[model samples]
Target chain A: MARREVSVLFFLALLCKAIAIRSQPSTIDASFCLSWRLAVETNNELPWRTVPNKCSQYVEDYLIHGQYERDLELIMEQALDYVNGISIVGDGKDAWILDVDDTCISNIYYYKSKNYGCDPYDPAAFRAWAMRGWCTAVPPILKLFNKLIDNEFKVILLTGRDKEILGQVTIDNLHNQGFIGYERLIMRTNIYKGQSAVTYKSNIRKNLEDEGYRIWGNVGDQWSDLQGYSFGNRTFKLPNPMYFVP
Target chain B: MARREVSVLFFLALLCKAIAIRSQPSTIDASFCLSWRLAVETNNELPWRTVPNKCSQYVEDYLIHGQYERDLELIMEQALDYVNGISIVGDGKDAWILDVDDTCISNIYYYKSKNYGCDPYDPAAFRAWAMRGWCTAVPPILKLFNKLIDNEFKVILLTGRDKEILGQVTIDNLHNQGFIGYERLIMRTNIYKGQSAVTYKSNIRKNLEDEGYRIWGNVGDQWSDLQGYSFGNRTFKLPNPMYFVP
Candidate 1:
């Protein structure tokens, strides 16, 4: 009897291990895929102000106590300097480029814990999660974006997030947190359902540069945000402490 | 014989009368409708290069005489300046934010004569057209982009195009024009699909700025292009005298 009980326990443990391996979370991948889909399908309808499970604590620890706050502040200050730093000179005309995700909002825990990247998804459950829409910005970074809006400079939120989920979710999330209104929101999407995030984001940035908006500053957690077909400028990187890159 | 001749003459006069009220050629309606259909359905994929008609003449004449050389030079110059306008002085690093469309490639004629807006799309046609790989950039503009590449400024291209189509067409188009490499292609998907173009673009720009890219310059044509989430220092507007708001 004792041997049989041990054998049963061992079998269950082995099965659990297999499932865990298969379900390792990829917060960046899942969040990224969701955001891209939202951008193309939902048109940036993300509920902007849902307090993400990991948001408040992450802000207090990594952002407030971590180096990110100072890093972001320094970045913002330099960005605001215009000619001296980002070449943002004078009035409300100067434009600043900011990234969503890890830069402005917190989504890591939701993506990681839920194992959202493992595919085999339930659309209804995903929508349910999105409906919660309670996320906090990366401490000083959130405050900084508000500063840009208050200072009269154009504040634009460019992200790999999907446009489809941004409407009520994004507006509510941001407005609830006191994030000011933005002039525009550029979301990444899947034009053909199987495109790379790299190509989509890069091409769009090129087109934006071609349009003549003076990009005084750019902020993001990854390198993709700062690089465009014709424009490369001063960028601030907040230690994602989470994850990014291939 | 006189009666027969009179009948024939009368018939001919009646045919002429039936067509007299028309202001232009009989094919004008078919053509206008066709162009409008192409514009609306095909995402501006009308092959002007393949249409060996007066439209070709118009294109040739415009390029050869309508300040083509001068405007090209100015656009190129402005593009370079806009890319160079950003810098990071106070911090450890800086970045640039670039807008795509008229700033990177030449797509105005396609959009203008064809007549297209962000909305009012034909899904199947737009999807196919979006997949086309020969979407080339304006010659002089390419030259300027290439110059920026040579100067070693990190290049990023932000645009309103979807990310799904980024792989083949956007890359091939920019690459065929000559570029050492590009860092990012920030794109906008269907996010903010119903919002004003200004609001949409601004959101994307702000996201980049928050990421810490000291945007130097943003070069584009439309006012929305020049004024997005991130306002660059120098905005270069190329001449797009043909199109208007949708």
Candidate 2:
């Protein structure tokens, strides 16, 4: 019995040795992960409070390694494949919905200058940056958009920015940043004031579908952009750990 | 001057109203969202820190509305539909991987008694719960598992539980709770001690694929379960706002 147990233990040890997982730091530790998450939530929701100072270094490290950009590229690659595989079911009705901020253009420079959540979000400063029309295109998503356009898919730009106040600047920024020829640019209206993003985007998409547009792909960095009815055939979410919309 | 500025003033008023995106709790003002978030990260990563008391009511409210259950059901329903649609390419090597805890059996009863992160995690008490073999199955996931089995896809169980310490108990618990006839049940060994869930699960899944098993679908509550390569053709994530696992 002792000999048999030794053999079994030996075999098990071999199996365990063969299975070496966790070699890479694919997932961050608990404290680090939580800190990162809190940074995002505070940035998007509670912009008044500053993120903990200790977490700033970790956030910088994450961004420095280009983690967010890498994830976006991989996810958008899948998006490309998915869109490429689909057959457009109708004419001028095959539309792809794209969220504006963070989805197509990045505000990383602005966030970085603010110490990556260590500083409170300043709406006036953000508006100033928006008006400058200098934010760079999120390369991966921009590439995906170009492919969709190349494939004859109607591209619609949707955003939460004030259409009346920032509308012209927003358009100029997209055009300046290499995004062009979108089917339509839909911005928040007085009707959607104070409403949740899910409610606002859902209503708009439903209206577009009602107008004979078939949303083939919907991509966004926020859950509000993807969830709810009238969500396209497939929804691709790009990472934005820096903020949560709601 | 007043008459000349009338047009600009009217336009500005229209713009302000139109741009009112973040007005109605643009973010949930309650500290609950942050607290709830911290709780999940702590449970999965640190497991030592006590989640704040202020967020307990919010967590309770989320649980009371059956939000977690509802989300799981919806996600699993999607998984079921996705798995059903796939055309099996291999003889019998196609598999559906599942995480055991929270994904299959739920420890909600034990958690509710602990005030949902108000108290520090007690492993001894948790082990006692594990030994009882009474934790209920996450209903929707259980249903998904049954369908996968019925569909003849190889159903494999992977979990972060220690194989040496709780292997038999885990097996019995799964079997007792209506989960039966899985192709394999993999648990963490001494070799993977103190590793992140993402690293551990990723290596294991990669190994399974290396052994020629084609993973068709993966369902889990944590990002760690779904992020790595050799991931299933499709990944269905269940909602678990209560606790995160790596």
Candidate 3:
């Protein structure tokens, strides 16, 4: 009876080890956690693609969602703390700031470029995207945004998406996503266009001071999204280990 | 006589061609002439390094006075226009914003990483500079800063230099540099500290708003100095091309 019990324990350990090996690619590391959304969207071969494989694998069942979500929450919380702590507008201070694409809408199709994301750079395809549908809201962020809005905060959706693709599409997307209460949707243009992501975003922030609505809090996946007010030109940087392919 | 005249003309033409080729590098491209100052001082090298060889050579001439000063006057006028025309500060009505250090001081030495100009990152050296002992002002900008101050509605000196450094060294440096009657000195660390440049400088801007200040202009050398208000993380920016070796 003792030998039988030991054999069962040995089988469970082996099963656990196998599950871990199959759920995550060996190359996946810490930094990639931040950009995982984009990564998974862009990579068809990503472990999540095989639904049954994921569920059957104990590692994916126990690890993927919880670990990924926890890391994301921590970074977002840190970012929100930095944004909300700001008091730089009106008599009491605070301004509206936002990011285009993922923050305000769903452009996950671009991930199809790897199997998930569409490359917005391709003119005709980009135009199709711009002309086609409204952006969808990201799941986790909706509740927080509503909470802030309830507290009397204004919103701004600043994105690195080309100015050419903005205007109506952006407004439609914002409305479709239920990302209301925004005073402006800042986008990149040829006039102020330059390579440095720092200048692109922060310069816009400097300009946004015009309406006297200082950004109270900003949320987005790329580091540059929240910038315009901080370190400089980095985009929603959180970690992007998953998708540097593009 | 026609042959002689042709020979003489030919010789002059060769001289002219040779001069054009040799001096090509010293001629600042019209495009760069406009944005180089802000871009350069913001990161010190973004524009200068990007300048074609012809334009790059022009920097040395501008480094000195005389014909170079004339060239500088033209560029400064353009820089002022760039600042005023496109600047997004103080409800888009503020006059100008300027950065200290490499922007105002001719710290090509520190930039080059060899001369160890007025303020070296070295603790003792920086402490000594903080002594304020007859520190010389950066030359090219002396006339510019003074000119703006004399005509000032508002002249803000925004710098990413640490607050602790603002003590005697910074105060004395400002005094010696002949800067006075400024509304504010935007400094670093008034916000939060992160390993990246974005958060370091953004905090300073946030604190300013808390104090009821409206930033009209922003100027600095490193990207963090001017555009740090972007997303919250500092990217340890690539480098100041003019001085950064690593």
Give, for candidate 1 chain A, the lowest lDDT window spanning 10 residues: A38-47
- Superposition error at B39 for model 2 (Å): 23
Best by DockQ: 2
Error of 1 at B94 (Å): 3.8
lDDT of candidate 2 vs native? Answer: 0.72
Could you tell which candidate, 2 or 3, scores higher by TM-score?
A: 2
Expressed as tens digits, the lDDT of each residue in A1-246 for candidate 1 is 356545754665565555444443223433333223212111111112232343333323333443344445544444445423343566555677777767787655554444323323344654565557776666667766877777666877776655676557866776676677787777755562344445565666567667766666667765455544433354554434333331
The candidate that wins on lDDT is: 2
Question: Chain A TM-score of each model, in the order shown?
Answer: 0.58, 0.80, 0.59
Model 1 TM-score, 2 decimals = 0.35
Measured against the true structure, the TM-scores of the candidates, in listed sequence, are 0.35, 0.48, 0.38
- Candidate achieving higher TM-score, 1 or 2: 2
* Residue A106 CA displacement from its true place in model 1, Å: 57
Arrange candidates, best DockQ first: 2, 3, 1
Model 1 misplacement above 4 A: A1-246, B1-60, B63-66, B78-93, B108-127, B165-167
TM-score of chain B of each: 0.60, 0.79, 0.53
What tier of docking accuracy does candidate 3 attain? incorrect
lDDT of each: 0.51, 0.72, 0.46
